[model samples]
Target chain A: MLIDIQNLVKDYQMDSVDVAALRGINLQVQKNEFVAIMGPSGSGKSTLMNILGCLDNPTSGVYRFNNTDVTGLNDDELSDIRNKHIGFIFQSFNLLKRMSALENVELPLMYAGIDKAKRMAMSKQALEKVGLADRMKHRPSELSGGQRQRVAIARALVNNPGMILADEPTGALDTTSSMEIMDVFKQLHTEGNTIIVITHEREIAACCKRIILIRDGLITSDTPNLN
Target chain B: MQQIRDNITKAILSLIDHKFRSFLTILGIIFGTASVIAMISIGEGTKKQAIAKYQDLGVSNIIIRDKDMTDAELQTVRMKFSKGLSVEDAKVISDVVPGVVSVSPQSEMKMEAKVGDRSAKASVIGVTPNIVSILNYRTAKGDFLTTDQYDRQLKVCVLGASIARELFSYDEPVGKSVKVEDQWFEVIGVMQPKALFTETVGELASRDLNNDIYIPLSTFNKRIPKVNPFTSDVKQLTVKLGNSEQLLPAAVVVRSLLNRRHFNNDDFSIIVPYELMKQEEKETRIYNLLLLSIAAISLVVGGIGIMNIMLASVLERTQEIGIRRAVGGKKKHIMSQFVTEAVVLSVAGGIIGVILGVTLSLVISWTTAVQTTITLYSILMAFSFSVIVGITFGYLPAKQAANLRPIESIRHE
Candidate 1:
């Protein structure tokens, strides 16, 4: 199992009032699986994505990644997991605006402590995989929305992590750019990379092989898509 | 090492992206460092000038001067059997005091020095040949008074540089005849121009040494009659010691001996140049410390400016920090990135400040009467202080940046 979570709970304090953002969520994701988490606003899917990406810790849970319990890991150890095992893509394409496409792709590898020459070679290969080889030197602002998403995908794939966590990966694109990003995700899935995308758009979620619906801090349904 | 290199590269890029803001942020550091260098250079120059002046006065020597008294006071001293300061006092101090090397007694009389049609008021001094060694006086032309001149009672004189110039214009005063107080004397030498004494030392009044003419003691006593009958035979005595270590004890003995010789009249005062030099050095050291602290305060103010800018920068880039943290950067990495940016800003400011400081010091030395010296250590100290200030003031901002939660910051608009 790449990720296994059981009885996960997350509580946030707001003005001295305890609000439960995630409560008793159980899920398992294996290697090479294509999963989509679907929910409305404030449905706790975003909080689950944050926990899955190691950006936050659950208040109470057993989160085991590659058979190692990660729930009790400290900040440094969790950062290591995020660097070496999990790659994240964001809805807004979260590419560092000051860096070139190649530099943005090299960010994860830089945090992984990879040497420079290898990092360059791997970033170049990843950009080429996303069909952005000729645009490697262009900054994110210089690229179109579709191209920027492609660059972000390159960054996500450069580290060759065990899984890729994307939050609303296609929510910022037009129909054409959204289709292009979906095709890239499908291509990545065919190459045996585990991909989990969080989105509310049914058309975007329908492109995934499996869909998990969440509502009000609870998982409502877990079903495999055959379309 | 690679991490640090990457952080530095990122910092440079970010600073370049916001060039005007970064420049404004380091302005305090630049002015602070420049002022530090300028102040230290000025202080050092003043110290060097003072040391040279004291060294020229002969650090191992003590001076005694006769009190300036009216004729009535002089008559009272004469009636009390005190002849003021005399050649006998010089002889007794050298002969009886331990650690005494030599003594030179001198008498001064103000009179008009005449050469041809030109006449200028000059202090005519009578001295033995030993005055040159005891007081570090040198001759610029010909030779100083010799033992032969003193023993033969020759009517020969040495003109001071300014006096020679005043009476002779461009012509050489040596081998020329100058008349003083109706006595004609041949000039054998011209003394070098000495530094001006702007302030009095003890009871000695400030006077321009270059406005004086020198004559042999025997000739002076024979040719120059006292305007007032009760005037002393000699007016000043310079005593040299073998080493400065015995200056205090020797001065004590000399003072007591003079008191006994004058029958406790207190008609003379002693001035030790070495002791005065030490006291001046202590005073200037306190002054330098005050200047340094003021400069340091400016540097600290500059540091606070940096911190203020950096804190604002961290707040402005919250989403950027979130992206870095979410992408796998640890707290240390984020911390180093901000710190490196702060360091780069301060170091650049330090370099520019050094250039400005050196220029300011040179301009001060060129345009003003005050001397300024730029030493290598002062430059290095200013530069290092700026760098330290950057790191020290950068800590709080960098910590605030590093401790930000990725989940919350990513959601921050």
Candidate 2:
């Protein structure tokens, strides 16, 4: 298994009240598995995704990635885990507006302490993978929405992370751009990349090989998506 | 080091992006450095001027002056002591004072000097032949009074430069005759221009040297009567010491000897030019320190400004920090990045300020009468101090930047 979440419980403090965002969630994702987490707003699917992405720690339970327990990690250690193992793609693209597409892609390699020339070459190849080879020098502001999302994808793939964790990957795009991004994800998964996506749209979720449905912080169903 | 270079490049880009903000941030540092350099330069210039002025007076010389007194006081002095200063004191000091190199005595009498159609009020001084060598006085014409002239009591006078110009424009004053209080004195030589002391010389009140006319001491005694019944015979004496180190002790010895001669009445005052020069240098050192401290305070304040701005910048760039951290940057990397940026900012400010300070000193010297000399050491010192300030004050902000939470900060709007 690339990611293993067992009996996860997460909570938030609102003033003095303990509001549980996730309670008793369990799931397992194997290497090269294309998984989609689906639920309506306030259904705790986002909370589950946060825990899975190493962006937030489970208040109580175990999250193991590649046989290493991630739930007990400290903030910096968790950051290292995120940097070395997980690649995140957000709904809003989250591209640093000040940086060019190439620099954005080189960011992961920078954290990896890769030298400049090698980092540039790796970033260039990643951009080429997303068919943005000619758009490397353009800032996010100058790029189209589809092009920006491609750069973000290139950044996620640059470090060769274990799994690409994306939240609402197609939320901010038109139909054509959405299909184009999904096509890249399909190709990445076909190339043996583990892809976990969080979304409520059935058509977007159908792009993945499996679906896990959650409601009110508990898993409701886990099944394969044949289509 | 490569991380620092990358950070510097990013900082330069950011500074370029926000040009006005960066300039405003470094303004205090610029002014602080400029003022520091300018202040030291001016103080050094003034100190040099004072030393040069004193050197012109001959540093090893000790001056003795007849104390200014009311007629009643003079009469009382005459009653208690034999009388006030006289040529006899110079003879006694030369003969008895162990370290005395030479003694020159002079007497002054107020008179009007006339040559052709010009007339000027001048103090006719009765000086021995040795006055020229003892006081470093140079003659422009004929010659100073000789021992034979003093013995013959010849009515010959040496004109001061200003008096010479006034009485004998275009004509050589030497060998020409000038009338002084109904006595015709032949002009023997014209003395070089002397430094004008604006303040009093010890117990002697201030007198203008420009109006002085010199004559042999013997001639003055034979030809002119005393201006006041109790007035000292010798108005002043210049005593040259063997070495500068012996100057204070020699002054002390000469003072005690004069006191014995005057029967314990303090009718004469001694002035040591070397001692006064040392005292002035000490005072100027304190003055220079005060200037440096004030400039240092401004630099500290400038540093605080940089710190404040950098802290605000870190706060504003929290998302950028989170982003960098997410990409694999360690704490040291982040620390070096911000620190490098800060150092670059200050170094740039320092270079600009050094250039500004040099220009400011030059401008001050040109626009005003006050002299200013910009030294290379001062520029280097100011520049290095500015860089240090940047590092010291920028440390806190850089640490704060490096310590930010990556996940939470990245999600910050």
The global C-alpha lDDT for each of the candidates, from Candidate 1 onward, is 0.91, 0.85
Clashing pairs in 1: none
Output DockQ, candidate 2.
0.38
Which regions in candidate 1 have their CA more than 4 angstroms from the true location? Answer: B114-119, B155-157, B168-192
lDDT of 1 by residue, B278-305 (tens): 9988999999999989998999999999
Once superposed on the true structure, which residue ranges of model 2 sit more than 4 Å away at CA?
A: A48-53, A71-76, B49-61, B70-88, B91-233, B242-245, B274-297, B373-385
Q: What are the per-residue Cα lDDT tens digits for candidate 2 across B264-305?
A: 998888887777778889999999999999998998898888
Model 1 C-alpha lDDT per residue in residues A1-227, reported as the tens digit of each score: 98899999999898999999888999999999999999999989999999999899899988898889988899999998888888888989998888999999999899999999999999999999999989999999999999999998998888888699999988889999999899999999999999999999999999999999999899999999999
Q: Native contacts recovered by candidate 2, as a share? A: 0.39
Best by DockQ: 1
Interface RMSD for every prediction, one decimal?
0.8, 2.2
The per-residue C-alpha lDDT of model 1 at residue B309 equals 98
